[model samples]
Target: MDTPDTPHVNKERIDTMEHLSAAIGVSRPTLSRYFQDPDNVSRTSRERIRKGLERVEYVPNFFATRMNRKSTGMIGVIIPYLNDLFFSRLLEAIERAAMDVGYTVITQCSHSDPAIEARAAETLMSMNVEGALVAPLGNHSDLDVHERLRSRLPFVMVDSRPDTMPEVDFVGTNHYHSTGLATEYLARVGGPPVFLAMPRVNFNAMERERAYIAKMEQLGLEPRIVGVEGVSGAGYFEAHGQAVLEREFSSGRLVASSILCVNDRVAIGALRAAATHGLEAGAMQRGGLRIAGHDDYPLCPYTVPSLTTVAQNVDAIGRTAVARLVESIRAEKSSGKQILKLFDGEMKIRESA
Candidate 1:
C-alpha cells in the first residue's frame, strides 16, 4: 500500500508515456496517435490504451504537444450568434465536415457585436488554427482582423461577409434568387405580399430585401416595406415582427392580403401576432392571411399552419466552405484571388400561402 506522503509512491505513479505504452502492449507511435486524437487510432487499440490509461492514471500533455507541432490540425468556426436555429444548424454541419477530414473544430460566438467578433478572430489566430470559416457581421466587422487572418492562413466566409473584404472567398445561399422565387410564388397563388424587412444587420437580410422589392416591382405590384424600429439581433426578428404586426393591425395599416417575412423566425412571430388579432394564417382557402418566409428553419414544419418558405442549402454551404478552406491550406502560395459561390434555395410550399 502506497501512502500519499511517500516519495517512492509518487515516483512510481508518475511513469513516462513510454513505460505506459509498453504496459498497454502498444507501440509508442500508436500511443502517441491516440493522445493526439483518439479517433486517429483503431477501435481495438484505442480501447486497450484507454484501459491502460485508467489502470495507470496516466495522461498525455496535449498543450505541450500542440506547442511542439508545426500544424495544430484544428479549424476555427465563428458565427455572429448561436441562439438562431439557422446558425446552430450551420455550425453543426461545418463541424461534421471538418471532422471528416481528420481536423478538430473550435467555435466562437460574437453575439452580433463588432468588437466581440474582432476578439474572437484574434483568439482563433492566436491558437494557430490551420484554417477558419466565419460568418462575419457584415458592415460591422473589423476589417483589420480579417486582413490579418487572410495574410496568415486560409480563411473562408460562410453565410455572410463584410463589404470591405472584396478579395475573400465566400459560400452562401443565393438570397436574391431565393427571395424572388418566394415572392413570385405568393403573387401567382395569392395576393402580392408585403415585405417584412429585417434589421439592417447582415448582407443576407439586405439582399433579401432588395430581391423582394425587385420581384414586387416586376410583378407590377407596389412594394411596401414594413420594419420595426429599434430592434436587432437574436430574438429581434420575431419580437419586431410581433410588434410591427400588432401596430399595423390596430392602425389598419396592413393592407396586403399576403405577407413575406425575411426569414422563418420572423414568420413564426407574425403568425403569433395574427392569432392575437383573431386572424387565422395560412392558405387563402382557410380564410387567413397568406404568409411565406425564407430560410426554412428546423421548426418551420411544426408551426401552426406549417410555414411556406425557401429552404437554404445549409449542408452544401458547410461542405463547400470546408473544402475550399482545405484547398487553400494545401496550396503552396496564397492566390489572393476571390471566389464567390452561391447555392440556390428551394421553395417549399406548404399549408401557409
Candidate 2:
C-alpha cells in the first residue's frame, strides 16, 4: 500500500535504476535534465529519458509538474455531437495534433445544446485551459460567455460559424463549394436534384443551402429546397423526411432526377425513405433516382449503393484551428472580429451518383 506522500520509489522501482543507466548509458543528472524539460535537452538525452521512464515505471506528479511550468500546457476541444463520424474524426485529429505539439487536450461533447456547450467552455476555462478549439452550437452559443472569455482566453471555432457576431475565428470547410460540388456531380450524372436539409440557421448549413440554390440556378434547374426540423441522421427525423419525399414523389412535385443531402448521414436516411417508398436509388447507369451527400463520413462507402458524397478537409481544419488558437493566445489579442477560414472538400463519386 503506497501513500500519496510516498510514491512507489522502493527497491522494485529503484532496482531498475542500474538497468536504466545501462540502457540510457547516462548519469542520473543528465537523465533528470530530460525529465525537467525534454525540449531543452538533447534529442539523445530525451530518448534515454523516455526509455528510462518505461523501464522504471515512473509516474511524475503531473499536478506539481504543471504548477512549476509557466503555462498549463492544456487545450480544450469542444464538439457539438460526438456521435457524428465527422465531428468525432475531427476531434481525434485535433487531439493528436495538439498532443504532438506538447499540449494536452481536454475534450467535451455538447450534445447539440447551447447551454451545455456554454457550460462546457466555461468549465474548461475554469480549469485554466490555455485555449479552446470549439464546434459552437450555431445560434445557440452564449455570446455573453464568449465575450467574457474574449478578455481572459482565446478560442477558435470549428465546423459552424457564428451568425452576425464578429468575435471569433473559424476553421471549417468550404461549405458552399462542397454543396455545389455535390449538386454538380448529381446534375452531371442524374440531372439536377432537390436539396434537402434541416433549418438553415446553422452557418455551415446556410452556406450549403446557398450553394445548392446557386448551382441549381446556374445549371438552369429549378431549386427544390426541402426543410425539416432537428439535425440530420436521426431515425425518426429521417422518417419525417421520407414521408415528405413520398408525398412529393407521389404528387410529381419532386423537381429533380435525384436529391442532394446535406451530409452522408442525411443521405443515408433519405435513401432509406426512398427505398421504403419503393423508389430505386443507386448508380446513374441503373438509377431510377440518384442520391448524393456531403461530408464523406466513415460509413459513406458502406452505405447502400455506396453513397457519393463531398469530403470536407476536416483534418486540415482541426490542425489549422489549434495552430491559430495557439498563435492567438500567445499574441494576447482577441480582435472580437471573426475570421472565417474555409478548407475545400473533395468530391467522392461512387455508385450512388
Candidate 3:
C-alpha cells in the first residue's frame, strides 16, 4: 500500500440518476436497470448507457439509491484480522464472487475483539445490508449478535463459527480431513509426529488440535500437544511458536524427531528455534528433523528449507458462501440447516517434511 505521489484531478460528478438520464437522453428506468446489471438492458441500450455514463462523468449515489429500494444488492462481511495472508486472500475471493453477482461488499475487521465484532454487525444492519458473511470470535464472540444476524437476514458464517450458534450456515476448511491427511503423510514418510498447537482462541484452533489428537491415537501413537493455553490469537504467532519451542529445547525434554505445527507461522517460528539449537529441519533422508504445518501461507514456500503444509480451498469457500447467502437473500429466509459446508485442503509437499 503506497500513496500516489502524483496528484491529478478535480472532476465534477453527476450524483442523481434523474439528472444523468436527462443529460444522457436515457430513461430513468433504463439507467436504474443498467446500474443494477448491464445485461438487464438491451444491447443498444447498454451501449447507449455506457457511452452516456462516460459523457456525464456519472457516479451513482449508492446511499441515496439504497434508501429508495427494498433490496440494496449489498452484502456485509466481518473478519477477524486483515494482516493474515490467508484472510487477505479469502477477502479477495469474496469480493470477486460478489462482483460477479452484481452485489457490493462492505467489510469490517474486528481485530480479535468481540465488542468490535458486535458493533460491526450492528453497523452492517444499520446500513440495511441484504445479507452477511461473518467470521465470528468463537468462544469470545457475542452470541446474541450472531443470533440476531441469523434471525434477521441471510447470514452465513465463514472460516470460523461460534460454538453456541450452531444453527447458522457455515463454510470453511474440513479440519478433520486436513489434519488426518497431514498427520498420516508424516507418519508414513517419517515417524509419528508431535503436534505443536495454537492457543484455544477460535473454533479452527480447537478443531485442528482435536483432529490431530484423533489422528495420532488412530495411528497407535501418543498424542503430545505443545502450546500455551488461554493466550491471545490476535497476532505474532511466530513469536509464540518460538517461545514455546525455545523453552522446550532449553529443558532438554524436546525429544520429538518430527513436529507438526498448527499453522505455517508457528512452523516458521519452529524453524527459528531449530536454528538457535543448531538443528536442521528438512526431509528425513537428509538426517534432518521433519517439520510440517497446515495452511499453506503465502510466505511458507519462501521460508528456510521451505514449509510443507495443507492449502485451504479459499476460492471454493468464498464462492459457496456467497452463492448460498444470495439464495437466502432472494428467498427471504435461511435453509435452517446446521450442516457446515466444508471444503477439502490439499497437501503441499515441500523440503521441510
Candidate with the greatest lDDT versus the true structure: 3
Instruction: Check candidate 3 and list the clashing pairs.
Output: none
**Pairs that collide, model 2:** none
Candidate 2: worst 10 consecutive residues by lDDT? 10-19
Candidate 1, 88-147: lDDT as tens digits: 989988989988987778899998888998899999998888998889877768878888
Clashes of 3: 0
Model 2 stretches with alpha carbons more than 4 Å out: 1-58, 229-243, 246-256, 284-287, 332-339
What lDDT is reached at residue 13 by model 2? 51
lDDT of 2 by residue, 1-353 (tens): 99899887633254343455666577765654455577867887787677656666555556555645678888888888777878888987898788778888988878887788778878888778888887777776776766666667787878886775555787888877888888887878776688877665566777788888898889898998875565344443345456556666777665346888877766777777677666657764453578888888898898777888999887888888888888777775555566679888899988777
Ten residues in sequence with the least summed lDDT for candidate 3: 228-237
Every candidate's CA RMSD: 5.7, 6.7, 4.8
- Cα deviation at 293, candidate 3, in Å, is 0.7
Every candidate's lDDT? 0.83, 0.74, 0.84
Candidate 1 residue pairs in backbone clash: none
Worst 10 residues of 1 by lDDT: 6-15
Q: Over the full model, what C-alpha lDDT does candidate 2 score relative to the true structure?
A: 0.74
Residue 240 displacement (Å), model 3: 1.0
